[model samples]
Target: PDMRAAEDAGARNAQLTKPPGALGRLEEVAIWYASWRGDPRPRIERPQVVVFAGNHGVTARGVSAFPAEVTAQMVGNFRAGGAAINQLAQAAGARMDVVALDLDRPTADFTEEPAMSEDEVVAALAAGWQAVDPEADLLVAGEMGIGNTTSAAALAAALFGGAGGDWVGRGTGVDDAGLARKAAVVDEGLALHPQAKDDPLEALRRLGGRELAAMAGALAAARAHRIPALLDGFICTAAAAVLEKASPGALDHCLAGHLSAEGAHGRLLQALGKAPLLDLGLRLGEGSGAALAMQVLKGALACHSGMSTFAEAGVSGG
Candidate 1:
C-alpha cells in the first residue's frame, strides 16, 4: 500500500476544505486508507459491520458486572436494530450482519462446558468471513460477549508475551476487589488452557469463543483479499492481534478503532504498532466505538474525493 499517495491527496485537499485539519482524525483516516490502497481518489464503498456474539466460561467467576445472558439479549437487540452498534452502523451508512456462534452463551446448552472444538472454530471463522462482501473497501469487527474481557486479557497475555495482569482491567466497572478476582480468574484460566500456553491458534481454540474466532477468521479473510478492517476496542483488537500472529501481514488490513477503557488495549495496540483514533474511555464492547471511528474514515474519503488541489481551485499559495 502506497500511503504516500493518500497523504499527497490529503495535502492537496486541505486548501479546499474550510479549515486545515478541521476534520482532525477523520482526515487522517481517509488519507491513511487512500495511501494504503495507493488510490489518491479513494472511496469508501459498502462499509460493513460484523458483530460476533458468544458466551465465555470465565464469566462464571463473577468477572463482569453483567450476566452471561446479556450476550444473547444484546445479539437479539442487534438483530432487531436497537443496540448502540446498530445505531452507529446505520448512521455510518454501513450494512450490518449479526453472527451468533455457540461458544458459551448464557442460555446455550454448553453454557457451563468448555470452549468450542478446533473444527467448530474454523467453521465459525468461515461464516464470519462470509458475512461481508469479499470486495468491500473496509471491514469492522465487533464483539458481544459477557466476560469477554477475561478471554481478551488472557489471549493478549499469550499472544503479546505478557502476563494476564498486563491485559486484564476493570471491565464494566469492576472495583479493585473485583479486578483482583478477575485477574486471578484470568491467571487460572491461562494456566489451565494448553492453547493459552502454546501457539496462538491453538490458544484461541482453547480459550476463544465463537465471536473471537470468527473475528479472527474475518480478519484473515479480509487481509487475504487486500481489504482493510477497523478493530473495535479490546476484544476485537485482541482477536485481530491473534489473527495477525496466525498470518503475517494480517495487521496491515486493520486500523485500531480507539483506545479502549480496557487496560490491555494499549499494550496490545503497542504490540501491533497501531495508534488508536479515539479515546472516549469506552468499555462497552459490541462495536460502538469502532462504528464511531468509521465516521472519521468517511470524512477522510470525502476529503480525498471532494477536495480540490491548489492548481485546480485556483487558490494562491504562500
Candidate 2:
C-alpha cells in the first residue's frame, strides 16, 4: 500500500503505452494521485462547487468600478441559471450550489455598520455545509460579493506575516486611484481588528465578507468529511489560506485550481506550497477556473483507470 510502490506500478503502466508523453500532464497527474493515495487506481467522485454570495463593506468607498448592487444582481443571475459560474459548472458537469450569506453590507441602511456575530457566522457556515453532500469526493469553493477583493486583500495583508502591501491587488477593475483607496481601506480594517492580527477566525470576522466566512466554514466541513477541496481564484484561495492556518493539515484536501492575476493569490499559493494546474491570467471569480480544471482531473483519472501498461498493451519501448 506504499505510495512509492503504487507510483512504480503507474510508471510501468505508462511505459507500456504506445506513445511516451502522449497523455501529457494527464499521465503525471494520474501517477501523482496514485502515489498519493497509495493505490494504482484513484477515482475522483462527487465533485461539487459551492458559490458563496455576500456584500462587502469596502464597496461603500468605491473600491471597485462596479456598483455594490451588482452583488445582488449577480446572485439573481446565478439563481436564474446564468453567469460564468453556471456555464463553467455545466461544462465540468459539477453540481453547483449558490448560498446567500447575510453578512455586514457596505450598502446597508444604517448609521453604523454592525459587525457579524460569531453565532451568525457559524450559522451561515452550517447552512453551507448542509448544502453539499458530505460524501463528495471533491469540493470547490467560490465567492461572489462586490468589494470582496478588498476584504480578501485585508485578510491577506494581516496574514502576510511580513508581506502585506506586496500581496494586495485590485478586484473587479479599479483605476490607480481606486487601488490606493482599496489598499488604505484594507490597512484601516486590519488596524480595527487588532485581535485578529494573527488569528484566522478573528480576521474573518473583522475583514472577511459573509461569503468568505462561509467559504471558510464550507472548507472546514469538507476537511472534516474527508473530501478534497479545490480553491478558485483570489478570494477563494485567501479563504482557504485562512482555514488552513486555523486548522493545520486542513489543506491536505486542497488543490490549487489555477495561478491567478491577483498578487495576494500568488503569495497564498506559495505559502501553501501548491502548484496551480493552470495560469491563464484568469482574474474572474465564481469557480470558473476550478471547474475547468476538473475536466483535466477527470481525464487523468480516466487514463489511470482505463489505460493499459506497456506489457498489457504489447507495445515495445527501448
Candidate 3:
C-alpha cells in the first residue's frame, strides 16, 4: 500500500545483478512486501495459519462426497494435529490454530432459512478477528466444512449471477450426480435470497457459513493491522468477497495463495482483483494452498535480500 517504498524497491531492483524484470512475479511479490512493510530486508519470521471449521446445514441436501459429520471429525483431527493442514503448517513452520465456530450442530439451511442469525454472524466475525495473532508477521485463513462449496457457489452466483453450472464445483471430488445436486442446492438458495445479491452482510448471513464470516473478519483485521494475509481456495475466497462487499479494498491486505481447481475460484479471484501466487490445480481446502504459497514468499524475500547488487558484485551494467 506504500507506493513510496515500492518505488524505492523498484529502483533497487533495477540496480540488482540481474536485468530489470528478469525475476518475473517473484520480483513483484518482493515489491509487494517492500511496499507494505517499508522493510529493506523484509522477512516472514512468524507466519501463522488460523483455521475455522464448521458444519453447513445445506449438507442435508446431499451435496458433498463426505458426510457432514466429517466436519466435526476433521476439526477433532485439526485439534489433535492430524489433518493435512496440520502437516502443512508444521512443514511451513507456522503456528496452527483451529477454531470451531459451529461444528456438529449445523446452521439453519439457507434454502429453507438463514445460515446464521445476525448475532451469530457478528459473534463469528468477532471471534475470527480476535483469532489473529498480533505478533504474527503473516497470517493465512483456512476453512473446513462439508457442503461449503455449495454455500460458496450460491454466494458467488448471487454476487456474480450466472447459471448454476457456472459457479458450482465438485467439492470433495463429488461425482456427476453429486455435482448436479450441489448445483441445484445453490440455484435453490440463490432463488430464495435474490435480494442478498446487493447486500453482502445479508449474503453471509443467508448463504455463507460461520467459518466464512470468521475468515472475512480475519481479513478485515489483517487490513487494519497492515498484516499481509494469504487467502486459501474457493471457500476462503468467497469469504473474502463478503469482506470486499462490506468494506471495499479489504482484500488489499491479503494475497491469493493459489488458483483452485474449483469452477468459480478464478472468477472470484478476478472479482477480488488479485492474481494468485500459485496455480497447482489445487482444490483441497484446509489451508494447504496457503501453506505451500508461503514458501514462495520466503523464496522471494530470500532472493531480494540475499542477492548482491551489480555494484557490490563488481559487475558492469550492460
Candidate 4:
C-alpha cells in the first residue's frame, strides 16, 4: 500500500463536508482503497469477478446435500449468465469470468488421502493466478465445488488448531445426520494428513479442493498487483486464510464482503479480524455477496471523490 496516498485520502476525508466519523466504516473503506490504488481519490472503473468451479471427491462421502455434478451444472449456469453471481456482478458493473478446473477428475477423497498432489495443486494455483485481469482495479473471487465446505473446514481446522466439529458446517443445506457425517469426514482427513497441519500451503493441497486453491492464488495475485479484493463467504474465506497463514498480513489489501449464514463463517472472520461490510444471511458460494458489497465500496468512493470540501462549498465548521 502507498502510505502517502493513504495519508492524503485521510486528510481529504477530514476536510469533507460531513462531520467527523459520520460515515463510519465507509470512510475507512475509502481510504484503504485509495492506498491500494495509489490514488488519493480513486474511482472503481473496472471491477472483475472470477468464479472458479471444481469437483470434490469428498462428495463421495456424502458430505454435501448436492451432487458433484452440480459443480459443472453451475459452471454452465455461470456461462449462461443465469447464476446469482452473474446478476450481482452485472449490477455492480463488473466483468465476470468463470473457470472450471478438471470437473471430470475430482480431487481424491480427503478422508482417505490427500485431496491433491503437489503438481495438481500447483496447476490449479496457476490457473487462478492467470485468471486475474491486470487492468482491474478491484477483484472478487468465488468458488463452485460440491463437498468443498468439508475441504474448507478441514483446512481451517488444520491451520488454526481446531477440532472438526468446531469448523464444520451444514453446507448445501445438509440435514443433521449429514452434518455430523461431514464433521467425521473432516476429522478423518485431518488424522490422515497430519503433515498439512505444519504447512499452510500443504494444508490447502491436502485438504482443499481445486476451486479453493484457485481462489487462494487469485487473492495472492491481486495482492501482487496491488488490487483490492472483496472476499466472499466461508469457502472463499478459507481459501484466503491459507495465504494469510503462509505470510502474515497477506490479506491487508482485502476486505470481508459479507457475513454468511454458514455456522463457522463468523468464527473464521473473527479469527482473521475482518469485520464484514454486510450480513444478509447469504451462504451462496457464487461471488454474489462480494459482488453485492462492491456497490457499498462504490458508494464510499463516490461520496469520497464527488463530495465537495467545506472550503469548496464555502461552509463553516464542516
Where does candidate 3 have its weakest 10-residue lDDT segment? 34-43
Candidate 3 stretches with Cα past 4 Å from truth are none
lDDT of 2 by residue, 30-75 (tens): 6655554556676776689888888866666777889877888888
The alpha-carbon RMSD values of the candidates against the true structure, listed in the order shown, are 3.2, 3.3, 1.4, 0.7
Model 1 residue 147 CA deviation (Å) reads 1.4
**TM-scores for every candidate against the unseen true structure:** 0.88, 0.87, 0.96, 0.99
When 1 and 2 are scored with lDDT, the better candidate is: 1
Number of the top candidate by lDDT? 4
Residue-by-residue lDDT tens digits, candidate 4, 1-318: 999999999999999998999999999999999999999999998999999999999999988888889999999999999999999999999999999999999999988888999999999999999999989999999999988899999999999988899998888899999989988998999999999999999999999989999999999999999999999999999999999999999999999999999879999999999999999999997888999999999999999988999999998973
lDDT for each candidate structure:
0.77, 0.74, 0.87, 0.94
**Backbone clash count, each prediction separately:** 3, 2, 0, 0
Candidate 4 clashes: the total is: 0
Model 1: clashing residue pairs? Answer: 3-35, 55-104, 195-203
Which runs in model 1 stand beyond 4 Å of their true positions? 2-28, 35-38, 103-114
Candidate 4 local distance difference test against the native:
0.94
Q: Write the per-residue lDDT of candidate 1 for residues 207-235, one digit (tens) a residue.
A: 66778888888887777666778888989
Task: Provide the lDDT at 141 for model 1.
Answer: 81
**What tens-digit string does per-residue lDDT give for candidate 3 at 1-318?**
788888887777778888888889889888888777766567778888999987889988998899888888888889999988999888888999899985857888999988999998898899899999887878899999998999989888877678678889998989999989888888888888887889998999899899989988887887777678888999999988988877787687788999999878999999889999999998989888988998888788788878889999999997
